[model samples]
Target chain A: MNFKMSVVVRTVADIMIIPIIVFGIYLILHGHLTPGGGFQGGAVIASATALLIVAWGTLKDNKDDFSTMESTGLTMFFLLALLGIIMGFSLFYNSLAGTGGIFGGTVSGINPGYINTGGTVPLMNIVVGLEVVAALSLILYMMAKRSDALEVEE
Target chain B: MLYYILQVLVLIGLVSTAVAVIWFKDLISAAIALGASSLILALQFYLLRAPDVAIAEAAVGAALTTAILIFAIKSTDRTEGYK
Candidate 1:
């Protein structure tokens, strides 16, 4: 089905996108202490990507955009994980920001009390979120686009 | 006592749903049943105090994965079984 939007509707959709992205970030940031974390928050962010693909008509036809973004996200995640490993820590390690304390909070690299204390955890969260968003958006967009094409062909 | 009962009920639900998914005739229905099983498992995860895994399972296993399967079902013939 062709989904056409009025200018006002498009404007509203555009305006709503930012809050969803920000909320995903917030979930990821407070993930360690709360009920949510990297995978969940990443999936939430991916949902926004899917929303954007649906709301923005350009994404429906642009196969290159989705593929490039998916590859870039995957590459960035792997590189970040590698960096964590190379910096004198295990792969996907949480402590790498040195052993300095953040005032009343726990030490930056070692120990562990503050939400932002993890060296690679926050970075990993961001990387995973990016990958998840890109991959999921691409998959959804491809599915929708293919279905539409198949319908037209039939 | 009640908590134990609830846990047992959830476990039974999970196992039954999984078996149904495996033994069901229709692939689409099986996928949906699998998603239901994932939701049940996620609930169990929450009950077991692993909220992170629970949330991930609910979102990916139940929602995103099921959506993908539904799309696949729409794209392919309904009568074909695991080729």
Candidate 2:
């Protein structure tokens, strides 16, 4: 089956990809302060993956890499959650808040929002974003590959 | 007034596209219609003050879902039922 689209599509996709990736990253990093978070940002990123597949078909089979990345994200998220419990707080507790950790930096007064004020929330967002991106992209890639192997029914 | 009118128009568009999904004989057309409906729904979500859901819907519902559906259709048949 001819999987590739016209030259117009390929060119547009190539040009549009950078902005989409940047926007997805923006959503992930600003998740603590904005209306979007890990899942949303990851979805946006995965949409880019979908666009690429639609335009040029699956370029490379990265199923194993995606699986490893997904596992790594999930494991890190779990470990980070566990850290809260070890610090004498409940599960998923905000232990790093006001403790002056990397993400626990404090602000003086009613500031808009210090990027560092989210404590473990930002870390959670990061890990969750990683897992979601990997998981969704893998799903798309697998589906595309499976479709390729199928014989079109008459 | 304008807000209410805009909402009404969006809702109308959403409904029409959804109906088009079912009305179309071509599977590809249905998938494209579904994508249009989902995009309109995303706009409705934004109008309802849920930007987060709007973003999610636009990304997943409108883009990814359509692509996946098209992929599925291509593997099977473009027309619904009967060769």
Candidate 3:
């Protein structure tokens, strides 16, 4: 059965979800310079998933997609760590720092912070963020679906 | 000064909300109280200069936890413990 909230809630969710997702991305991208990082930004995006479930009810499908995304993110994270070791650095090492390449600039003084100055930090942040978002969203979706199924059975 | 006063007030609110969560017989009220407590705790984290913790606490604790609890509550009894 299709279950949805009131028009007002749906409208609010429609308007608010995009901004929430955008803010989460911003947090993930600027994680090295900002206070928030992968876990926090991912939690923010997962909260958006909660909002969507609340407004639109249980999603009919797409559970597999979330699971796949989660797996892919974690795999990429591990691969990056392995790459670090192959490059003669320790596992999870920040090898690209100050190399004058992409994500290699250095912020020497007190400044506003550069977008590409965090080396491997920004990449790890994005990878971990994706994994967290997918995992938490999957949990939320599963819980919602189960609850809905029980409701329909009763 | 004013900052300390605000902090104290927020702490008081946080404690009271925790107590409310324990005291409520209605599970939904307890869940909502828990969400409020989480929100206040996030504010406290911000005041303590931990914006990362504050944001995560707000999003996961206040928002998602409350939503999950509400959904779980819908599938079962609303009263505390056994009827």
Candidate 4:
């Protein structure tokens, strides 16, 4: 049925969710020069979603938003990948590197690290992070809803 | 010397947890054991000089999989078979 966790668990979940989300974003944003990437970051964010679902029972159905996000991420990823082709490069090419644009900074030899580098990689990481966050959250939400929906006898 | 010892201990923990996952009769206990196994595996991955795989495994394997299993278990039976 509509099962909500105890107050202690709920409070902890509330407190912990913020850091988890921030770390996930950081993972996605600095994926180029870091150990984490889109998928890992997305999964981390979805874990926060999972924590929410477990702490507080599934109430509002935000499936539509998540669906739109997943679709948008995928479409954007493809568009970004194909943009390199229009720019006279192969699919998934790093055309923006050394261009001094958004994510177009350059890295030479073995420097420390720079955030504004890695061309299309960071862009893909963001899009993939979006898709994964939506996808995994959607999955957790659906399962939580389904579990709630199931008929249980006393 | 210490590094090798730590790696060996982690591997041992990983193997024991894997066995515990199968040995537990209660579904919740089994799920928790599986989570422990995943965590130890993640640690092993970290020790092996692969932090990326370690982070992914720790996040996905230890957390999400255990939550899903518990949720699925709550809907039906909490034990093995019809005992």
Q: What is every candidate's C-alpha DockQ against the true complex, given to 2 decimals?
A: 0.39, 0.67, 0.72, 0.71
> Top model by DockQ, which number?
3
lDDT of 3 by residue, B1-83 (tens): 99999999999999999999999999999999999999999999999889989999998999989988988898777899865
- The stretch of ten residues in a row with the least summed lDDT in candidate 1 chain B is B74-83
Using lDDT as the yardstick, the better of models 1 and 4 is 4
CAPRI verdict (incorrect, acceptable, medium, high) for model 4: medium
The residue ranges of model 1 lying beyond 4 angstroms of the native Cα positions read A1-23, A48-59, A84-95, A98-113, A148-154, B19-28, B79-83
Candidate 2 lDDT, A53-137, residue by residue in tens: 8889785978899999999999999999998889988889888888886888876756787788788888898999999999999
lDDT of 3: 0.90
C-alpha positional error of residue B26 in candidate 2 after TM-score superposition, expressed in Å: 1.0
Stretches of candidate 2 above 4 Å error? A106-110, A151-154
Better of 2 and 4 by TM-score: 4
Q: Each prediction's TM-score against the native?
A: 0.71, 0.91, 0.93, 0.94
Q: Candidate 4 chain B: worst 10 consecutive residues by lDDT?
A: B74-83
Across A1-154, the per-residue lDDT of candidate 4 in tens digits comes to: 2788999999999999999999999999988898999988999999999889888987478999999999999999999999899999899887888899898888898989999898889999999999999998888888778876776667
For A1-154, candidate 3 gives per-residue lDDT tens digits of 1388999999999899899999999999989998889999999999988888888986658889999999999999998788779899889887888888889999987999999898888888999999999999998898888875774443
Question: What CA RMSD would you report for each candidate?
Answer: 5.1, 2.8, 2.1, 2.4
Which ten-residue region of model 2 chain A has the weakest summed lDDT? A105-114
lDDT of 3 at A78: 93
Winner on DockQ (2 vs 3): 3
